[model samples]
Target: MPPSSALRRFFVCPSHRAFTLVELLAVIAIIAILAALLIPVAGAMRKKARETRCLSNLKNAGMAFFNYQAENRDRFPPACERSTGSWRAFDTLLGYTDATAELLHCPLDEIPRVRSLRPRSYAMNDPLWQRESWPGVSLNDMDNPSRTILLSEWFVDGNTTGSESYCDLGNPGTFAHANGTAGNVLWYDGHVSQLSSASHDTNQQYYNFR
Candidate 1:
């Protein structure tokens, strides 16, 4: 025989069950734990994002040099202007490319534009040409353009006469994007990559390709 009507009704419509206070607290605690776990990850992501932007700026700089070189019979821009005999590649390139001076400034560099147009955060490779006779040299005469560096983060060591060079290796501020372990370098062949502090000075060719 089938069950009574009252029994069938009870089975079909069971009373709603409310979560206990402890269960609600447990769910809130779980959410809090997950949030705490993501904090560091979020910070790292933001750092990497800034790093990508810095690299893009460096890449733009390298391309500008190429455009400069093509029009001047493959000769790279001068490391310093002859009128003042000071390393001001930024100024020289701006004249050639008609790009805003701030495009060459590193994003991480907080120096105000009014204080310094170039911000002293980037410098050209010293081996690309001689300060005395740069126009005579050409990129076609260089070797290993793929491995050679074009420009990198600057390192000021009190003696800045030839200090506007890409030799700011193994410094905390130079590699701001990588927690000071590695910094981004734009190679002569129009590619950008990270250069570790240890390997920065290991080979003379890394900086001195000429």
Candidate 2:
């Protein structure tokens, strides 16, 4: 026997239901909790991306040093200029390598430009070369090029304020890193690595080339 039209209509018009207040609130609470959990993870991913970029910049800068040396009697630039500034010394490589003023700036740096020009984020290891009173160090002078630190993430501290781009291992506490605990360091052999602040201070080998 076939169903009646009224029976079909009754089945088709079955009652509809909507979420109650409690169910709606529970869904909203779940979304909020998930969002809260993901926020920190998103922040950490951003920091890691910035750190990776910083490492690339340091690596390119290290290559620039090697290129600069190849043409300039195999000698590294002075750690910093005595009269002008550290940026001035690094500027000497502008024509030698593919690196530009923009490449010298770190992605994590809050202060992009201090003076009219873009401020440098990396600093040459001051101990890599002798003081201004003595001559600059050459590749031949390094006892172990693989272990020597050439350039590192630099920042200003209490004693060294203003737009300066030089890292003195003597003041290890002043060294800054995007990760907060360790920094990307460029070695003379043209490799980049992350060294913890504690290791950087305790291990004199990173600071001393001899």
- On the 0 to 100 scale, the lDDT of residue 75 in model 2 is 76
After the best TM-score superposition of candidate 2, give how far the Cα of residue 188 lies from its true spot, in angstroms: 1.3
Reference-based lDDT, residue 146, model 2: 75
Clashes of each: 0, 0
Q: Which ten residues in a row have the lowest lDDT in candidate 2?
A: 161-170
Encode model 1's per-residue lDDT on 74-98: one tens digit a residue: 7886675434435556666776664
Which sections of candidate 2 miss by over 4 Å? 1-15, 96-99, 111-113, 127-136, 155-175, 178-181, 201-210
Candidate 2, residue 2: how far the Cα is off, in Å: 15
The lDDT of each candidate is 0.65, 0.67
Candidate 1 regions off by >4 Å? Answer: 1-20, 81-87, 92-102, 108-114, 127-136, 156-173, 206-210
Best by lDDT: 2
Best by TM-score: 2
TM-score of each: 0.68, 0.72
Residue 182 shift from truth in candidate 2, angstroms: 3.1
